[model samples]
Target: MPEFKQFLLADTAEGLTEAEILSVRVQPGDEVTVNQVVCEVETAKAAVELPIPWAGKVTEILVEPGQTVEVGAPILTVDVDPAGGASVNGSAPAAEEEMKPLVGYGSKTVTTKRRARREVTPEAPVTKGGYVPLAKPPVRKLAKELGVDLRALATSVDGVITREDVQRAAAPAAPTAPAAAPVSSGARERRVPIKGVRKATAQAMVSSAFTAPHVTEFLTVDVTPMMELREKLKKHPSFAGVKLTPLAFAAKAVCLAVKRTPDVNASWDEAAGEIVYKDYVHLGIAAATPRGLVVPKIRDADAMSLAELAAALEQLTTTAREGKTPPADMLGGTITITNVGVFGVDTGTPIINPGESAILAFGAIKDMPWVVDGQLAVRKVLQLALSFDHRLVDGQQGSQFLADVGAILADPAMAITY
Candidate 1:
């Protein structure tokens, strides 16, 4: 008789409660070796591939994709040899030393392999042009933005509708903008489920907004000197192979400014009825990805050089935008910066991340008339907005912190004073 071994879903990292089953890679009776990836899951963090620790034949797949299951729950069951000799399909049992630890090693060596994707079928036919066309999430979002009805081109395409089709469909009139989603005649609304990163972000924002008394301050600065210095640094041999960005300069500035106004780097300890202050800075850069907005931190950012900061920022944001930022990377942020300027916006109030007292919003850089030595002339100007927890940081402290950041950006030399 074959003995059965139930494979339980383990917590991939700290504070993991549960995860959504993203996909199952094996079917019942499929032979698997030790450490063979069996499924993929999406936690509040990132997508993780789970590998079976035991070599056996997959007896049952207990859960389906998109279902949320708690940690320690059985995700699948495998049949093993009763005597623990040869395993599934007569393969020798894996050596004990070669097996990955089951508890927290859920994602280690979890290779990325493309599983044949399931066909996406439209759910309803109540739209203006009939049932929605078959397309991936990104393609759908693109079509909606371009105003090209999916149903209109559904018949023209053989299978899934590509982004090119939508762009081509909308080229006649709104050539620049692809138009989709004819909502005039059909259902007035659709709902997106709040889960994963989106769900976690909603909860955090609400909690932070309600618990922290937020105070935001704004400043405008001429960044011509900073921009000029940046160009000079780009040509320097030491800065080569580094991706220098304005955000990096802002990060370096924030670190320098924190030395003077440490209150912005502190967090409120409500449970302890005291304030927690730190000498070191774990600077978080707010990133926008397909999943949602995530702020991953640069550990000990205060100690890094400008070049190091720039390289770290490049790696951090790229990982985030790819939706591969690990759960551990997203935790323990001391302060955050959101570069809204990349989207060409002037400035807006930003919310502070949880556990941190302050968040900075860096706005677009533009040429504006400025008074230089009492003469109005065109200069590169940038806007800054700083939001802080009023309960922890007083108005004066917040303003000073914002001023310190702006001063460094306006004149990089000002950082030396801080």
Candidate 2:
């Protein structure tokens, strides 16, 4: 007789209430091993893979893809003793007195309760007047919008209908109109659900903007020397295989500037009624991802060499773009930098990220006419804007920090003197 066991979705981190199932890897009757990835789920912070605890043949999957499930909900069931063939005698093996723990089981103690099974009939089509098909609410809405009858469409999986099924049914109707037809004629407005990383970012921005009093200061500097230095570093052996951008130099400048103005590297603790100053710098780089804007931190960025900082930035952006950044990496940031230059835009007043006192915006560098040594010449000019929390940082400190950053860019050699 085969023994059956159930697996629940454990909370991956504290304060995580739920996660949406992105993909299901295993199905009924498929054998799996312990610690094998069973599915992928997306929380508010990031997407994570869930593994099964017991090695067995899958008996049933309770949750479908695109469905949001709460923590501690049963996701699937498996038969631990598949070779016993318990179905031949129409009887299941007796429940074990003690069960092994799974990866997602957490530290909580497990309790078992048995209940009699009840038989369920298959859902009938709308014409037969039995019941509607098993489709999620969002999928049902999409099917209605596309004029697709859920019961009339064929599904690859048993017992459930999916969004893909509706899309396939609707694809045949698209060619009725001309390919060049305007989309606005069909649907004037499209709505997207705000959740996951986007939702968290929105809430954080709102909180930060309202709670903190922001003061922005802008500075324009000639960065011709900085650009020339980058060209020289390209030929250096230590910079081989590293893509050195102006952001790397700006990051180093900020790290050094913080030492002169340590208040910028502190956070205001509202609950404790205190301002916390950090000794080590956990620098944050704001990267725009397909999902949304995410700030992943570089641990001890102040101590890293130029080459090391470039490498860390490369890995951080790659992980963020792939939506694989973990929640732990997104916390405990001391300062941040947003490179608006990548979008070819000038500086703007950026809101401080929650828990951080200051943020710097690096603007696009352009070649323009400037007076150098009382003579007109074309030089690389760039703009920098610094936004700080008025509660912790004053005008004098903010201006000095921005000035130091500008001086470093104006002359890369000033980094050594400062």
Candidate 3:
């Protein structure tokens, strides 16, 4: 007789009610060790890896990938004493005292790893014109962008193509013809199942747009001084290893501007009939990931120096792009910034993120002719737009806040006075 133990989904973090099973790493009869990740799940905020607590052979998997399960639900069962001779009730004496706690269950450190996927049958080899390559979607997209034909690469590693293979193939590449357009002949309408992050984002956006009265204000400024400062900072010892960009300056400006206009860092509490003003700022940076838009916050952003802010932004964006941002980092945001300029587009009216009163949109920076005193010269210029909850932030406050941000960007020295 073997003692079976059930592994329930523990509360991974605060405010997480349920998660969608992204992948199942183990199956029945597989031997697993304690703390080994058994599956991955995606919550409304971030994707998380769940580790099994008991070491044993898997007896059964209760949940499948893509199915949402609530916290405390039994996800899998394991036989602790697979060699037999255990209590009939499946209780191993002293099991509780011998088990080690799983890391990151309630801590800031997050563990994320995927087990090696089971190999699939090798597809047919490539001919000249009709060969399909073995690669993930992102790897294929990279190959297409780099003008490397995946069919040309030799599949020596488990008959699968990887990102490194695509990069190596593109290393000594010459100019190649544009990729042929994808040909399709069928009904144009396609129905995409809206679930996971996409579904949550759609619902939040709809609610915010309808519930909050939005007001947008725009300002155009000469950012020549800010650009010059960035170039100088890059060579400075204190700023070494920091990838400072216009966004950093914009972030710092928002922090300082919020001090002057606290309403921008507030939330409208209609049910309570009170406006909640946040004394501290958890600055949110909106990142467009493969899944959808995710805004991960930098905690206590107003207290950080320029270098610290830059590093925080870099880490936040990287985590988001890799689809590993923890759900805790996506909550409690006081205000947000969206850089549409990265895509080479000018500013647009951005909607306020739910729970936050204001959002800023940074537009493309361009060199254009401008009047300096009485002389015309080409200068770095930027367009900025701020959207706010009109109920909390009136037109006057919105204008002042946007103007202050523009002023700081136009002249970095003004930040000291602010």
Candidate 4:
């Protein structure tokens, strides 16, 4: 005898209500170990890998990739030895009474789905010859989502209708050659469903744009000294293997400038009727990934040395681009920096993140003619744009913060005195 058990989808991160299935790592009949990654899911915050708690034969995969599931919903099922295999993961598996029911499933008779060959219900209409479509619950759900009628295909492919059957049936009708003239080939338009990180980022941007009263200020600075120092540091023995990028320098400058003008590191609490000023700076560096735009933070950036900030920046950007940034790393950011310069763009008014008071857009650095003490010379120049919430930061504070950052970048020596 074999005991069947279901492993429900738990919230991977705090406050996560739903997640989209990125991929399924195991198939039916596959042996799995405890704490092994069973699947990957993308929540609003970040992409996360979910591990299975049970070590047994995977009996079923209840969800398909591209499907979004609510927390506590059944995701997978496994079969364990019935005689005494209850302690698959050490202590006796969590009792059925301990599992929390899926949200919105109140008082509904919960039942596990069985193999399609088991039985057909009366509600399921039978075809002309009493042939009821045999498909698992997950396949049926997929068919419904794609607007495919399983009954119409009752001339059943084989025995049980599978995921591929539903997909093949749902595909658009092939373009036929016209009798009068040959029809043109290929689809000109492409449509992609917006459901994952892109969808979440859109909603967040909309909310931030409407909720926060934004004011953007721009400042152009001569960074000849900064660029010169970068070259000198690269040759130094201490900076071996360090990525001393302009973005890293900008991040360090932002952290230092925050100490002189703390308003940029504060947030407005409408409900609490107060301004929340943070003593420690959690600097967020916006990185664009293949999935979408994500801002991963460097904690207590103000306390980190320049070398440490550069190392953290390199690691953070690499992880983010690989889509492995943890959900927790993307939260609780006090201030943000978007390096538009990476794309060779000058500058733009960037939108502030929801919980943060301000965001700085670092532009591309290039050679420009400048008046240095009544002398015209070619200097490395870059533009900086700071967008802040008007309710939390005023014009004077924002200008001061921008000026302080520019001063440090123009002359690294100023950082020592500050």
Give the per-residue lDDT of model 2 (tens digit) for 1-418. 6787767776676456568899999988788998999999988778889888888888888899889886556677778888878432233323433344448546554533322322223453345564456766546755765688776765544445666777797786544655675556346777777777887788678768878899999999999999999999989999999988999999999998998999999999865789999998999999998878989899999999888888888889899999999877888899999999989988999989988999999999999899999999999999999999999999999999999999999998988876
Worst 10 residues of 4 by lDDT: 97-106
> In candidate 3, what residue range of length 10 has the lowest lDDT sum?
109-118
Clashing pairs in 1: 146-178, 146-179, 146-180, 147-178, 147-179, 147-180, 148-179, 148-180
Q: Which segments of model 2 are wrong by more than 4 Å?
A: 1-3, 81-186
Query: What TM-score quantifies how close candidate 3 is to the native fold?
Result: 0.75
lDDT of 3 by residue, 154-265 (tens): 7545566776787787787668899989876569866676777886788578768977889998999999999999999999998888889899999999999999999999
RMSD after CA superposition, every candidate: 14.7, 12.2, 17.1, 11.8
Q: How high is each candidate's TM-score?
A: 0.75, 0.76, 0.75, 0.76
Candidate 4: tens digits of C-alpha lDDT, residues 69-185? 866667877665534443333232333423433332243434333334533445665567765577765467557656887776543433567666777887989889767875565
Clashes of 3: 0
Clashes of 2: 0
lDDT values, one for every candidate? 0.81, 0.82, 0.82, 0.81
Q: Give the TM-score of candidate 2.
A: 0.76
Off by over 4 Å in 3: 83-187
